[model samples]
Each structure stands twice: as structure tokens, then as C-alpha cells.
Target: MEKLINEIDSIVMETQQITKQFQKGDEVEVTSHKLGFVGSYYEATIVSIEDANHYRVKYKTLLTDDQSAPLEELVPIGHVRPVSSHQLGTTSENRFRQYDKVDVFSSDGWWFGFISGIIEENYYVHFPTTGQEVAYPSHALRFHQEWSNDDWEA
Candidate 1:
């Protein structure tokens, strides 16, 4: 697993050197599973490229009937792959070793649950890595990392 992840990291770095076309006002198509934008792709902004190979996109979902209301608010979709430049984002932070617990967050800011057993078809979870078990579609999850028990204010 370590070797595979290292290989993936190298591929990411190589693609970083290539120039890609991304704009500020462009109607970006981000992949997720929400509503009109769920699974359907989202109209977002190409905020700015944080680095040579990375892009920063902001996604927002409006209420179905209420124009002024937002079914979901804006946060971060996250870093994407360089080869598939148009993808939204999903993060596999530092990574969780066996027995580590995690809290899964949906794009609209909802916590699905804590880490559970792994299955083939994403039963309780969706995309299951070695330690990270996926519960919802990539878009459904907006935030997930090791569940921190430390006090941030400390």
C-alpha cells in the first residue's frame, strides 16, 4: 500500500509541471451527489490556482424553490488530480492506520457517521481504501480526516 501511494504521489507531481487552462468566471463542472448539482455536476468558480498543477474551485448549491436560499453553502471541494483536471476533490489526509476512527462529512456539511467495517460495494461506507472507508459518493463527502480529540483552543 505504501508503495502504491508513493507511486500515485509521483504521478501527481509530474502532472503539476504541465500548464492547464482554468478560469475565474468559468462554469466549472464539479462531480458530487447532491441535487440538480448532485451527480449532475455543479456550476462553480475557478477561484484561483494555488500552485502550478493545482486549482481552487468554490461550489454552492441554491435551494430548489427559494431563489435566495441555499440548499448548501460554500466551503472547499478540495485538491484534484492533474490528469483529470476537471474533477472536484476528495481528500485522504495523512491517512488512518488500522483502528483509527474518522468522521465523514458530506459536501453540504453533514456527518454521515464514524468509521466502520469495510465492504465491497460501499455499504455503510462508499469508497473504501485500506483504512479509510467511503460511505457516500465523493461529492457527498466534503470533509473527513482523523477524528481529532485534541482541543483546538488549547
Candidate 2:
């Protein structure tokens, strides 16, 4: 029927628009109604786009090593605006400070680093091992103690 055709077209168009808003390698928050994720947001990597609306996402917090989910349940993190520090009834002093040692997660695994700077709620971490810089959300980082070059571990 013409109505069915129109609905399908609408779905396809909407999917395309949503897909355009995200890209491979972007971090996203995935929430699933099934099991433990019922009320939590999990950090994930947008591995690839399987179709207009589905994305292959690898969960950063998988209990086992390297588990990936099919495109059906992933949502881009950037789609949601982060709450400002003031909104949490906190101030800049209560947040992570510059040069603070922190552990950041990456595709390889969790890496140790220091907070170089902050852009909004995201922290720029400098990894001493490879001299690489990466940006991670606050949830993806943890407070850490300073480490020497010889004591570093990935």
C-alpha cells in the first residue's frame, strides 16, 4: 500500500540522518533493556555501521575480553549533552585538575596517563609510553598515582 511505502521511506530517511550524526571510531553510550544494562549506560566504540540504523559496537566494560554487539542497541554519546559541573552542584576545584595522573581506557586496554587538559567534560590524556594524546570521557578515566618510566604498565 502507499501508506506502507511511505512509512518505510520515512524509516530509511530517519536512519540515514542518524547514521550521519555518528562515524566509525567515535565513542558512544549503549543501553540495553536486557539484563544488567537496564538502568546503566555503557561506554562503547562505534566499530562500524552495518546499515542505515545499526552499528557494530564494542563495549569497553565487557566482563570478558573483546565482546562486540550488533548494531541494534548502540547510541552515540555525543547525541546527549553532558551535564555542566555547576549542574552537579560542584565547582572546577572539585573536578580533575591539570597534570593529575589518571588511567584511561583505549581499544587496546586501559592505559596509564596524566590529564593534560579538559575540553568541557572530556579530558585530554597524555600517554608517556608512546607519547600519544587521547581524549576520553570522565567515566572512562580514573584517578591514579604518578608513575615512573620503568614502572609503567599498560
Candidate 3:
């Protein structure tokens, strides 16, 4: 819905603030109780920042220890908050950033997609879950403080 996208846009703006409070390689812990399905707890590395509202969080599955099995999480700036100031014996200053790739899902909560490219006013996505190439007009997608990064691998 248009309203949803607008709301998400507003929240995404905070990524800049969160980034300013943190930085790459900073050990971070995320509380998941209030978010999407992955919402329970998340511990990851601030691998990269794409912008002020998005982040490339590199972390492993909590239940798995396979180093090769790594997931780069795209968390909104507003969704990630400081739970611990000290991560791995260091303090982090939010850097307000994002990643080129962000996980996206459909409005029905039944789709998972990855942003493959970013343009001036839109992005192209290859949704593995549905095997569909979808284009988003930036204004069509909605984001919540809690977001779902699940999609079928296309």
C-alpha cells in the first residue's frame, strides 16, 4: 500500500542515525522479540553501510555454527537499536548506513526477494522464492520496524 511505503520511508530515514551510532566490524546484538519471524535475537557484525536507513549485517544462524553458512542481513536503520554498548570488547559509534542488497518480501507475507540493483527511483529484484523478476518503484514497498527477509530462492 502507498501508506505502508510512506511509513517505511519515514523509518528508513533513521538508518542514518543508527549508522552514526555504530560502525563496521562492530560486534552487535539485536533483540528480536518485537520484529518479524527472525525476531527473537540476532548477533552480527556491522559488515557495511549502504546508506543511512539500511545495513549489510553479516551474521550466522544462531542455531548453526558453519562459518561458510553466512547470511548478510539488511536491517532498517530504525529496526536496529543499541542493546549493548560493548561488542567484542569495543564500543561502536552508529554509522548510519545500508547495503546495496536488501531483503524484500511481498505484501502478502508470502514472498521473499533480493534487491539486485538500485536505480534513481526504483530497484530491480530477482525473487528466488517465486522465480520472478520484480521491479519496485520505491514508493510501492512498505517497511516496518520489524521486517521479513524471507523469500523463495529464484
Candidate 4:
């Protein structure tokens, strides 16, 4: 596992180039950078472009302290991604491979990661956002895809 984690780290470093831009009203998924909320992503809409590196977004699921309104804040551009359109169904057979982009079911939500290693029936997933690795069964993993123009594409 240690060796696999090291390889995953290297793979993560090689894939750090993200150049995504969004216009106001575009729906997206934003990874939480907060202390306790790390590793989870919530649905949000880009309310406005704050600047070159940030977006003022209104979360669909996250709420403010008083619970009266949706939480709105400036999220770093790197932490936001377009909404995923294709979600694979869970199955018993191992259908994923190392370095494959996938979403792992954990913490009551699907957290994005890559398949770092496969051991028998379990898969080691590496999450770039939190720099964490976890082993999950095949049923807990799914292919990650992006939504584009009313269609799902890889």
C-alpha cells in the first residue's frame, strides 16, 4: 500500500493542470476546502465571476449558519468543476483500472478520485483534493464523466 500510495502521489502531481472556466449561471460541483467539509463536493451555481481565480457561487445543498439561505461564497477556480453527467451503475465485477478517474462512495456522498491500485476485490482510491487514499469495494466505485451540451462525454 505504501508503494501504491507513492505512485498515486506521483500520478497526482502529473495531472495537476486544470484550466476550467465558467460563466455566470453555469452549474458546477465545488469541492469543499473547509476544515471539516474537506473531501466532499456540493452542487452549486456560478453566481458571478469574482476575478480571474475565483467564482462567487451559491451552493444548492450547503446553507448559511442561520439556515435561512443557501451558502454563497467565493470558491477558488481550481476547486470547482463542471457537473458530471455520466454516472455508472454499481456492479460486483471489478470494472475499473489504475489511474482511471472515478467517484468513490463514502461519507454519504460521492467523492472524486482516481483508482490508484487494485488488490483482489478492493480498489485503492486516491483523492487529490484531500490527499487521502482509501480502499473500497467494486460496488463503491463508478466511472467519472463530464456533462457537455445536454450529453455525457468522457
Candidate 5:
């Protein structure tokens, strides 16, 4: 059992490292740093690559002040991640493991983070935007996914 778990972990790590660079028209999720939206990732399409470390994305949900068009902005590449292929499901504490990307319910919205450690019935999640580690009960955590092509894939 232990060996099998190790093998699975290896596969997961390799898959994560295999993510390639983003290109135009690629659907993705971008972390928002705006007030009241920090730590939240929003659906977006890569409209253009500004450079090696920046992308001009048009948000699917966010809109302009006049609400006439979708909001577009330049986002740092590090703040973007490929849309997750896992869907949110019933909370199962045992299903979580170290290094797994997850979202935690907080401040009225789901905040993107990763499982840094597990302690008994609690998970220590690290939020990259805040550089903070927080403990959350399993019930408040879920696998991160993005809504794409009229369905949830991550």
C-alpha cells in the first residue's frame, strides 16, 4: 500500500511539472488581487501574451465599471494556472493529501490555496497571495476546479 501511494505521488508530481506555457485563446484561471477579490481565481481567456511573464486576459465573470464588456487586464504569469480538471465534490477528509491544490471557503468566497500539511482532522493550507498558512476543517475545503465549455473541469 505504501509503495503504491508513493508511485501515485510520483505520477502526480510529474504531471504537475509537465504543464506547458500558456498560449493565445487558452482557457485559464487567474488569481485576482483586487480589493475584496484577493485569493480568488476567476475564469479567463488568454487574449494575448504580453511577454514571457505576462498575459493579457479577458475575464469571463468580471466586467467593466459600465458593465458593457468583460474586464481585460494584464496578469502576471505566476498568478495564472491551468484550469483544474477535477470537480468539486462532497468533502472527504481522508481524500486530501499534502501538496494537493485546493480551495478553502472563506470571507464569502472560495480562495485558492494548497494543502501544505495535514494534522489529524485539520488541514494547513498555504495561500500564495498572502504568504499565510491557515488551518481549516475539512468541511471548508474542496478540490479546485474551473468552469469551462459550459461545464466544470477542474
Candidate 6:
């Protein structure tokens, strides 16, 4: 029994020391679970490696604080692969026009905004929360529904 316990402890320590798929500085996206349904995904940084498959993640773009998740829930971004062709979901041309509400992926993470104009394949977006505008590729954006904010109307 003593030998068996010692071997188990050694295995645990060895597994903990193994480098995780994502490092402390790696950028990743964590899926949000609401009512047991998969919901919106938020961008985050891997703050620390809790174990072989778990990570301490920080979602600075979100209004909330940091959270932790498993490796299966993270999609690596930034210096690694950034955005892949599959993730962009641009198998073919997607139609998007001006004044359409959309969610765009920026360095600051995914944000809900309106398309102010289009310049070729890129769309100029205006975020109401920050009143900032930027041009984003169509592949990095998706349609979003409007919010009921009558008080913000002019």
C-alpha cells in the first residue's frame, strides 16, 4: 500500500510538470455556458497553468473578473496561429451591408457594433459602447441583433 501511494504521488507530480498546451502568456477564447447551453465566447489570456489541462484565464475585455477553464475550452490566438481559415468561416463570400449590427473580433476581443460603411472587403464599424470606429475584415465579423436602448437614442 505504501509503495502504491508513493507511485501515484510521483505520477501526479510528473503530470503537473508537463508543459500545458497553452502557456501563461498564450491568448485563448473561453466559451461561456448559460443554462447548460454553449453561449458567447470571450477572448482571454492564460494567466497560469493550474495543471496539465486546466488554466487560469483572464478576460480583460469583459466587464467581469478573471476565470479558469480547461484546455478543451480554449482556442489559441495571437502569436500562435492567430485566426485560422476555418475559424474565419469564409468558405465563400458573405453579404454584409451598411447599418447592420455585427460582432467583430478586434485586439480588444469580440465587440458588438454597427457597420458604418464598407471599403471593399473590409467594413468600417462603430462601437456604441466606446464610440470608436475601426475597419475589420468580413471573416472576423458576424451579424448581431440590436439592443433595446431607447435612452441612448438621440
Which wins on lDDT, candidate 2 or candidate 4? 4
Best by TM-score: 4
For each candidate in turn, the TM-score is: 0.29, 0.35, 0.35, 0.59, 0.52, 0.39
TM-score (C-alpha) between model 1 and the true structure: 0.29
Give stretches of model 2 more than 4 Å off. 1-94, 146-154
TM-score for candidate 5: 0.52
Kindly report which residue pairs in candidate 1 clash with one another: 34-38, 35-38, 125-134, 125-135, 126-134, 126-135, 127-134
lDDT of 6 by residue, 1-154 (tens): 4553353233222212222266677765554333321223456677776654456676656543332533332322221111112234244565777876566776545555668899987889876545678998888887652211211110
Worst 10 residues of 2 by lDDT: 80-89
How much does candidate 4 score in TM-score?
0.59
Best by lDDT: 4
| Model 5 CA deviation exceeding 4 Å by range | 1-19, 91-110, 113-141, 144-154
Q: Is candidate 2 or candidate 3 better by lDDT?
A: 2
The list of candidate 4 runs beyond 4 A from truth reads 7-16, 91-109, 112-141, 144-154
In model 4, residue pairs whose N, Cα or C atoms come closer than 3 Å (at least 3 residues apart or on different chains), thus clashing, are: none
lDDT of 5 by residue, 12-124 (tens): 22212223578999998777556656657667899999998789999887788998999999987766767656545344453888877688867534687778898987889
Residue 64 lDDT (model 3): 32
Predictions in order: lDDT: 0.36, 0.49, 0.45, 0.72, 0.70, 0.51
lDDT of 1 by residue, 102-143 (tens): 233444423323334434423244222223345444443232
Instruction: List ranges where model 6 is wrong by over 4 Å.
Output: 1-93, 145-154
